[model samples]
Target: MATVDRVEIEQAQKLWQPQPGWLNTASYGLPPEPAWTAVQDALADWRVGRTSWEGWGEATERSRAAFANLVGVPVADVATGAVVSQLLAPVAAALPPGATVVAPEVEFTSNLFPWLVQAERGVRVRTVPLAKLVDAIDAGTDLVAFSLVQSADGAVAPYDEIVAAARAHGALVAVDATQACGWLPFDAARADVVVVGAYKWLMAPRGTAFAYLAPDLRDRLRPDAAGWYAGEDPHASYYGPPLRLAADARRFDISPAWFSWVGTAPALDLLAEIGVPAVHEHNVALANRFLAGLGRPPGDSAIVAVEVPGARERLERAGVRAAVRAGRVRASFHVYSTSDDVDLALNALTG
Candidate 1:
């Protein structure tokens, strides 16, 4: 039996409702009111010249610590990247000069491009079927990178099998956990690197995210494209004399996005209030309602393929703003989304 948890769920949905034609989470990621309130304060603080390198330095440390706490890891092992792109930097740098980076066939470029461009060092990138990923990480592959929940299908990958396979082949695993961050609970023990971009479910603004490098794997990464902050003595060192990189994952922290720190905190505070599991259940329930409303797909299709044209049109005709990608209608159901909101989306889709 599904527990009815419309209390905070309704608040989140009502606060972040989408207008017509608002389909993609990509184009219009709706954050809660509290998130906006936080960002507004951060922006005001920024305008007043309250944030500085050191101030942000402390903020970065705090954000990283918060992220580490969320992922169940020690703060010392966490790295703060202003954006998710740099989050992949350490993983790319850690690979051998000439290595194969294997990824699932369909992926957000966040997980694909960094490795694809690795040809400079003779690093080969291979696109494999998602179903075969567990069997595909043979001795030839150096690192296997992909998202835990693929963006296209909204299908959560079997993390345990993927990790076991990579470990069995002695390969490092880099998970683009942007989609799974709030949708599910993640175990850091299963992955060497778990990079989560905060914009989507964490309800943070763009340019805000964190990358968790497994404590044991922290020492193995070579900080490529590092800066002053990468060093332990960055504060006192001059002329970049024999630049020393940070011994911990803090080496990855270049600087900070002052505004995101401000805008992101309120929602984070709310997340702390509602709790992760409850939020996850809320999302799951909405997805279930939408999926159930889809009823039975055509004999062959399990869910609507996003690539199919008019998915947005069809959902719109039914009365809800929706995105059809891969093969599922990707809908956002937050703490604010009520049974009515779920019913609205489902009714619009199934009608």
Candidate 2:
């Protein structure tokens, strides 16, 4: 059962400086006041010439636990990273040379480029349309890379079906859930590797992200880029001469941004307290409202995309916040967004 309700979520929205009909969370999320409070407390400790290793470490671990909970996985499966690119570099490198990677061409370029770049170095990268993605995977394919939700058009991918097919062929699956993590419920345990950029939907600051690697997959891949922090006892890494890495997913973690970790604790706590199912329900309702206002069938996604010419200018003049992607205006919803916010965006488009 959810401990927090719509009233509590609406109250939490007050912490963020109210936007002028903001609906653009898909591009970037608004920071809550609690996140700032956490950052300020950490900075104050830093100013006193006192480093709270315990406090800092606890914050980092708490973030890992929180993300694990969000993805329905154990904390041992989660690895922290400075950003998606840094985390994905190891994942991309882990693939056997000459492996075939299947991906959608229209996905967020971060999810696309890493796999595509492998083409230059003996790997086969096949870019296909989203509808054709499942058919592209077969016995010859070694990896399948894709976003959980299409960023440009807000289309949800057939993830479970794709994962099942990929697994049947001995292909590893990598998912970028940055766009879908907080607003939609997914079984993270299904993917071999799940990466999330926390700043967007997870409601954390920039410079924070995480990757979840299956226990078996961790041992199978070569730890070529494992840094000093990858070890079980990161502090003892310098004191001892042994270059031992963690037995679990921690081996993939890079040096994390401490401040972002501090902020992440509270942000994730808020969502967990509210419950993802509740948040998903709220955002879906708003998305449906927005679609209905436009007289379109609901796509059952938090993002409501419409093709509008001069979208940027029109939204700007109307004080409506949205993202322009692939010539479409994308207005995304969060638990904080209300029916009014959807109506405001709809009116801006039609009026």
Model number with the top TM-score: 2
The parts of candidate 2 lying over 4 Å away from their true place are: 1-5, 48-54
- For model 2, residues 10-84, the per-residue Cα lDDT tens digits are 776787775667887888776777887989888898889577656766677888999999899989999998677
Candidate 1 lDDT over residue span 33-111, tens digit each = 8778766766676688876645545555656666777778888777777666678976786678889888899978988
TM-scores of the models, in the given order? 0.84, 0.93
TM-score of 1: 0.84
RMSD of 2: 2.1
Model 2, CA-based lDDT: 0.83
User: Which residue pairs show collisions in model 2?
Assistant: none
Q: Which structure among the candidates has the greatest lDDT?
A: 2
